[model samples]
Target chain A: MHDDLYLALRQCIIDGDPEQAIELCQRALAAGIAALDAINEGLVPGLNHVGEQFAQGEMFLPDLVMAGEAMKAATAILEPAMQKAGARRETLGKVVLGTVQGDIHEIGKTLVGTMLSASGFEVHDLGVDVPFETFAVKARELNADVVGVSALLTTTMTGQKNVVEALERHGLRPRVKIVVGGAPVTRSWGEEIGADGYGEDALAAVALAKTLLGK
Target chain B: MQPKLEILERELIERILGEAFTLIAEPGVKVQAPAAVELLAGAGARIEEGVAHIPEALARRALASAPREFFLHNRAGEAVVRYGGDAVQFDPGSSCVHILDPATLEHRMTQAADLVRLVQVAEMLPQYAAQSTAVVCNDVPKETGDLYRLFLVLLHSSKPIVTGAFAAHSVPVMIELLAADSGGREALRRKPRAVFDVCPSPPLHWSEFAGQNLADLARAGVPAEVVSVPLAGAAAPVTLAGTLVQHAAECISGIVIHQLAQPGAPVVWGGAPAIFDMRSGITAMGAVETAMLNVACAQVGKHLGLPTHGYLTGSDAKVMDAQAGMESGVAALMGALGGINMISGAGMLDSLACHSAEKLVLDAETIAMAQRVLQGIRPRGESLALAMFAQAGLRGEFLKLAETRKLFRSEQHLPSSVIDRGSLHAWEQSGAKDTFARARERVAELLAAYRRPALAAEVEGELKAIVGEQARRAGMEQLPGLGT
Candidate 1:
């Protein structure tokens, strides 16, 4: 019976049905299966499958985003149960993300956040037009392991450097890894801005975050 | 009279526009510029998380104010290139990074001298009505590259230019360069000697830089050409018609932002769309489907009574071979027949990554043929060919007749030595050169014949000072290819 429940949970994520995923989580709880097992044996494996398909070009951006949505919804349902049982999901790191100030481009930054969260990172997306101080404050409050700044315009990409300086001014530079990305951000630009790393795209961002945390 | 080609049916175009307007109001366009968002919100567009759901009524209002025609003027203030109503013109492709070396048969990074040579060659060719910043100069700093190109074009060529900016900040400076050449900002606006090409990101999005450019160009009364690029099956829908709907939506939203900033600004419904080759993962600019997409997209623009432009006459071949000729020739004919007002991409190859001056000369012959085709068949006299036949009287001497002499010059298109029409004996005497060899010779002859156009000393001094300041700001001591 537990095996069937785990299989159904995996199917919920692959099919990207958030409501169905929530229903299955409740069923797992009612059937007395551990919430941690449901996630480790079911949800993570399903997301891994989606990631593999995405890398192979079998899946696209919308599919990956939907799968991420299903995972987020399913996790919310089991969080209370997992805490009651003194269980925890393994996280790679905590990441604070946003499109830098004076720029409103959101698609790329949102994609990077979703991918990081789905890959087991604790993501706090600050949203678009975020001030540099907000990034510093968030990193200090959340004790984030990584901070990713995005800018889609050549004119506004200078904000990435401002972000790096803000982190240094707050003395959060040593603890937090800085990763800059966008359509205009390049590897050399990241180096020039004193960023720890650069993500050419969302997938690369996730991988770079993992490497930074030594996972 | 000119022959015309239409790919989309009247009903299909209406359906595409209808679907496009619905898309604009539903998913809306993701505008990254805050000022643009404010303008749309003030115009009654529903804003949701930076996406503006523009109403159909607003788009129509913008379209109504856009001018249906505009002119790009030469340095002498002659209206040489028209952008409306089946007036076909051609210019070399813009912003290539490599120039193909005829000796090495390999691509090398371009420098300021390469661009100067291209401008000089293009100036002598009557086939290219306007000039383009044909190649990027690798010697210059990246931040100042866009302005540096325009400065070089103004200094080297007398023709009006088609150029674009890499960033929003660069746009104003480039415009200032043009204004300095035209006496003042208002004079430049009145007889605009240049048109800036602004592109929007595909799948219903416009980056902040592009949005800002649209607004600035509109307020300044400079012409803006909206180059909407949608790669099929990758960034957009796989089907051609579906891509057209996306293209129309992007362009319609761009026009809305442009016209809202300033009413009655000149904008061209232009695009450089191509099919994504699934096998190679490249945008095949030379494919027939790409040409169809360009022609059909222009058809939609014409249906709305707007000026049209398309990127054609480019090839994906690596060299000046048969593939280059076939791809470039066919597309040039199709674009001309389809009535694209300003057809670009003449010397471009390798999917628009490289430019070759020899290929530019060769493509001029191809363009000459296409222009001849556009003339179609016309009756010159009352009896057609009967008068010439009567004068010859079955003696097989029509070539010697006065009527033949008088009419053949107008009737026949006399291509240059780039195209061979001599007998084998004559060809051997001329060294039996292939088309590329002949094109190389032609390029050399044209460059030799190029003469710089005269400019007032004060205007020249103003241009030098402006460009010199920019060069210093970019940390360069002196400009490349310009002697003190």
Candidate 2:
């Protein structure tokens, strides 16, 4: 019965049915299944499958977005139960992401955020045109393992460098790795700016984040 | 000429229109402007909670009142662009915040110099029928960015402009500036030099600013192009057909309000519709499905016998690579074959986030090729070159024939120097440049050849004064120099 529940939850997420995903979580909990077991065996695998499909180009943005919604619904129900039982939900890492200051481009950063979350990282999206200090402050507050900076223009690449400087100044550079990506951002620029890593696109971002965490 | 393409059947178009008419009355459209609501309410529309229920007869009547075609005149007082029929004109994409610098091949915040260069390039290129206020100069204050771009375009080029007003209040000043350029308000009306693009928020919502612009542009006798964007899957519906229904409904509502403002002010059925790529959560402008949406929606507009416009010749690729070429090439061809009157989105890249002058010139080549295809087998004199073929006698070399020399220029589209049709040895001698490198060279050459179209000194001073006055009102004391 637990195995069937897991399959149902995974299928619900793949189908992008958030309400069904939450109800299945509740039903699994009512049936005396452990919350962490439900998350690891069901929600995580569901997100992983969705991510794989997205990478393989079998699924598009709306499907992935729906899957994200479903995963959130399942997590919302299971997370509280896990806390009550004194168990913690496993995360790959925590990341704070934003488009750098003076660059109002949001799609690239938003894509990276969604892909990271689907790959098991907890993400705090600070949104577009985020100032440098905000990145460090948010990273320190969240105790994030990674902070991804995005700049779509060459002019705004300075904002990414400023973010790295702020992270070092806050004494959080050692704990939090910095990853940068945008249209104009290159691997050489990443090295020049003292970034921990670089992503050519959103899929590469997920891989870079994993390598940064040594996962 | 190439054969025209149609994505929607006549019956299906009728059904879509019928559904849109019903949609306007049923759930209805939300109008945020009290003045627009009053206009619709006065025009026999039922209003409740800011939503106006327009009747089918009222919509039909409005459509009938709007002129089927109108012309935008150039500075020389020549009607250079017609907004109806099978006229296919290209314009560089508008309002991009960043420019893809050809020299460094990097994106940067657009400057006033960038806008000026863009206009100069478009002014020189025969491919673009009109020049657009292509980019927002970030060097200037944001409040006056839109009108400021237009000001620079007017200052730099003699071509009629495709532009928009960013603020509702800036509309009258912009009109005044155009009038000053054209000698006066009455003369500007008689030969309007610019068409303002007005937009409505998708899913049947028109903002107060949008309504005000539409009403003001209508009352001023300036042409207004309604750009209604509906993102299929995310904003409208997952299906393209459902999105088309929403597109028609939005456009119909826009026209209802526009015609209500004035009985017969010109408004084009224009939109930028794209499929919501579910995986990336992007409105994929480069996708074939997105191009189909534009074609199909324009078909609905054409069936209603209105002037139509669409966003095409755009790409989602971040770089000027193969993906950009393929996506933009296909979109441009489809839009051309689709017969959209005023096709925008040329020179646009990264899903319209960035503009490149190199890409603009290259896309013009693509448009030239599309125009050749549109010419579709002109046999001339009711015969298939019978006399020339008879003289050549099948498979005979026509290269030396006098007929070939005389007719070749007309029959074939001989591309400009930008396109490389040379021997490999010649290419190697010419710096071993790829198309991008060659395009960069061409851009420099064009800029070297560019001369700012002459304007009366008094008129030029007046245009500058108006822009400066508006910048001051917006809390910016000085207008940023165009850096010409």
Candidate 3:
């Protein structure tokens, strides 16, 4: 019965049925399934799979956003039991992320922000065309362990170096590991610019942030 | 093959080139590099010493005669790097000297072995055309940046190289080094093993170094790909239309130089430009808009009736993490969809700063899917009728059809382990590994099974000796494990 409920919850999430997830959580609760069990065995696992499929392009971003909402709803329902059991989700690390100025491209930034959030990083996404100072300001405000900046041009890729230089001028360098990414960034580049980390893609970004945060 | 961009159909392409030619003739390119201007003048371009006034008729005539498509012959398969062919081929660029390892989360120095392994894997993938020359081995010297990457990639694979030199001084030497493996330098010139990239500064200009490189590479008969980088909102016109015009102008001018250097010489109109980041002021490689602009400009190249190349396959989504997968996948998908010829920048990570073997494998799987997507559907005569459908029956399942079993595998793409096909329970059984973890294992397996290409003993000796000579010239006591 536990296995069946778990599978059903997973399918519901994969199918992107938020209402069904909430309904199933209620049903599982009535069936005497522990709220913690509902979350651990049902919600988180389902969403993780959802993220995997979405990443693989077996599904798309709509599926991911819906599954995120479903996971949130399930987590909310299981909150009391989770708190009672002292179940704490370990945040990998806090990341202050944003797209650099002049370019308004946001999908990649939004996708990273979403994945990082789901991966348990506290992401402070200072939306599109973020000003350079905002990064230092937000990193300080959030006490962020990593600052991830995104640019998408040969001209704009220089902005990543500028952000690191700005951080250095403000004495924010080394205090917070700054990572830069976009279509044009390279690791040698990260080293050339003295950045703490560089991710070729978004998932690696999250993992790098975790490492920087010492998770 | 994806359908041609409607607005950029053959007639329109001819028309675009016509307009581009007019722009070039009326306002010849401003050659910022005197050496380049001299070369162009010497080669036949109408130049009054420093200024090159490219005639529109010459630009169009040269491109009109140039082939619209070409093929890179590799053992795996003939990858059609089509300006207009079966599909666009994407090769990740060469030589990022550092990588942020996802496993360690720390930035580590990159090595030449990393590049060799990457080229081997990139060779296996259907997406890449000629493994890139940018493999940097940290164990080797770093004076030439990624020349070591190119050397090892040559040693490891026979794939054509989509590479560029970081320093102008090394371009000829590197090309000479590449020739050591095949026939003498002259014979190597015939087959054209590598495509040297030349970029014009956007807003209609060319750097002294880049311009000279273009002229010299053209003189060498090595295929030259003129890269016009117009960063929208930065070095380029902010509007997309403006950017395309600037791109056309640059390519037209470069084409005139290339043709005049040696009329009928091969050249690919290419670029890796993206919009500038207004915030920190950098070129962002991960923006969808950048990738989109890349495709649109490729349309301009097609308009010029020339084969187009764009280094649009890498993304700065940073890590090989989810962000990397999505951003890389999107660019790969669009690039294939747009039918770009010879798309470079594969396997790049950290926005383009790093290259990962694992991500190379994963991107290959993504390319396979994207290639399938670009294939659209093949409606052969056998597939045109309801007769086969009748055999499957009404309200029916394909699982029960004998024909379904026969054709399913061929019709559908069976993705590598990079794609998780396991159900929840099966996935749980497999230790619930993430995509990155699975990709890592797959990378290990592919590398383990890799067989190095065979070279004639003399060729092998020569290739090794070149590296040895280079090492010696650089004052190395001995060359690393490159066998003589």
lDDT of 3 by residue, A58-79 (tens): 7655566667667666666767
Per-prediction TM-score: 0.75, 0.83, 0.66
List the candidate numbers ranked by DockQ, top first.
2, 1, 3
Location of the lowest summed lDDT over 10 successive residues in candidate 2 chain B? B475-484
Across residues B94-152, which tens digit of lDDT does each residue of candidate 3 receive? Answer: 55755657578565666655566677777666667667765556576544444555677
Model 2, residue B334: distance off in Å is: 1.9
Candidate-wise lDDT, in order = 0.89, 0.86, 0.70
Residue B128 displacement in candidate 2 (angstroms): 0.8
Models sorted by lDDT, best on top: 1, 2, 3
Model 1, total clashes: 0
Model 2, span B107-179: residue lDDT tens: 8778888888888888888989999989878777767877888899988899988999766788998899899
Q: Of 1 and 2, which scores higher on DockQ?
A: 2
Which stretch of 10 consecutive residues in model 3 chain B shows the poorest summed lDDT? B73-82
Q: By DockQ thresholds, what CAPRI class is model 3?
A: incorrect
- Which lDDT tens digits does candidate 1 get at residues B163-198? 998888898899899999988999998999988889
TM (B chain), model 1: 0.98
Model 2: which docking level applies? acceptable
